[model samples]
Target: MDDLSRDIIRQKYPEFKEIPSQIANGTKYMPYFKDCNGVIDDTLIDVIIHKENQLCYKGRKETPTIDVLQAYNFDLLFTYVLSGWEELAHDSHIFLNTIGNPSINFPKPPPGKYYLVDKGYLERKSYLTRYHKIRYHPSEFCGANPRGQ
Candidate 1:
């Protein structure tokens, strides 16, 4: 995170480590999320690009758009944002590029802390994602008894 962003988090959420009682008591996920600082995801935003550059921006979706990477804390406050990546760029690719490029100054989690990400992101040391083999979809878990563990 940048200096301004860090200051905002510090000022707004001084007790960042403290999980709210409601969330902690209501969900099993909160216990395992003690070390999670926030969540990260990328989204495609439609845009009207010049015809010359449209081809480069086109991806699986027919619409021309830019993929934007964003990070948000538990409070749903935006902590970081990276924009301008072409739609063709995958989530993992953007994440890797942001962290790998020193110039980008991607906010990295501190030691023992991590950012929760979806399976589209790399399963790296500081990124927490679900195991590929797990039945993660909500629909898959529906039934009288549910299915797998």
Candidate 2:
């Protein structure tokens, strides 16, 4: 099933061949993210495991789950996916492990480019994360601009 889904997505959307038009030209996502290639994140998907092995997969969620790491472009097409991690694993740990292991061949951002990540991951050379305690989502900017910290 995984192979089928991946094949279908690959055949339908095709991999991002170059910098997205929005970022390439001075359009909507320019200035702030002109050098951004894409986004990377991880999610926990509920899964059924044998009773004996359930303990290792149990985490915050009531049911067992597997952490799936995915990287996608601004067009919302998945460029890469690494799944089957136990739910108990931390997102940072999984991210580091994936990049450290040469066999995986993770899609690293080009020099001077980066991937926008959420608070779950740390800020690094090619990965940019929000400042701690700062409001990021637009919804938080209600009515007028934010006041002094």
Candidate 3:
């Protein structure tokens, strides 16, 4: 990357140990050894991309926003991030545009490893996203569940 890009990235990400992945607590503390799960999600920062193009969702009026797609571990360390996406863009679209490549850009998991994600992502080999027809909330799971929720 050029100096400007490097500077931007430096500002966006913290100084971190360069590794593929690491298991939280294990003897084999090597790169690509970490678990990728639940920690992947996107949040909108206050900065707006569009001023007049506001949206109304549910019951609230939503303003234009800049979305930050972040991935963290159990320790809350950011492993991956993608910024500058418009608020109206879909999460799956962002993932596809950035990650759907013959030469994958994101960190690769081990043979049997996969990530835990929400329903926004497509059902893929390396991601374990939430199912479409399941109730994951505690209230929905109050009664006896034969599926062992």
Candidate 4:
């Protein structure tokens, strides 16, 4: 499915081929969600491919094998940018990282609206509260919490 999606994107949007990483690693595609006010409403879900190799030797013969893992990476910035929601005032907590260093941060979106996200996006609350006119934090944590304390 991941490969099929990549092929479809490449066929539909030739410009994607220009992206260096896309050309090399066969494009990482993401899906984004936005609110009525044009603020980003969810993390961008991306499909990433992991490659590995295996080596085998039989007497005087040698062979190599390859493997792939269909993994996902969620990037906050990719959500807003891909959704064409830049019309917002750029003051909302529009971006979030769902893994590794779980964090969320972005400039205020607009005077009357803000982005909504989960608690995993805790890194930027201070700024969101101060500048964003309104922000919604979901009660659940949707990503890993490194500080398990």
Global lDDT scores for all candidate models? 0.72, 0.72, 0.54, 0.26
* Residues 1-149, model 2: lDDT tens digits: 13222443331233334666656664444678877777889888999999999997998867888898887776677777888888878889888887667766666766777888867887789899878887567665466321212
* Candidate 4 TM-score over all chains jointly: 0.21
lDDT of 4 by residue, 56-127 (tens): 111122332121112121221222222212222121322332112222122333333234433323434321
Ranking by TM-score: 2, 1, 3, 4
C-alpha displacement of 148 in model 3, angstroms?
23
RMSD (CA, Å), each prediction: 5.9, 6.4, 8.8, 18.6
- Listed in order, each prediction's TM-score against the native is 0.75, 0.77, 0.58, 0.21
Question: What is the overall TM-score of model 1 with all chains considered together?
Answer: 0.75
Stretches of candidate 4 exceeding 4 Å from the true structure = 1-50, 53-108, 123-149
Judging by lDDT, tell me the better candidate of 2 and 3. Answer: 2
lDDT of 3 by residue, 1-149 (tens): 01122223221223223233235433444334454442567777655434354452111235556667666654555566667666677889877765565342455445566666657877678777776787668875468432223
Clashes of each: 1, 0, 5, 7
lDDT: worst 10-residue window of model 3: 1-10
Residue 106 shift from truth in candidate 2, angstroms: 0.6
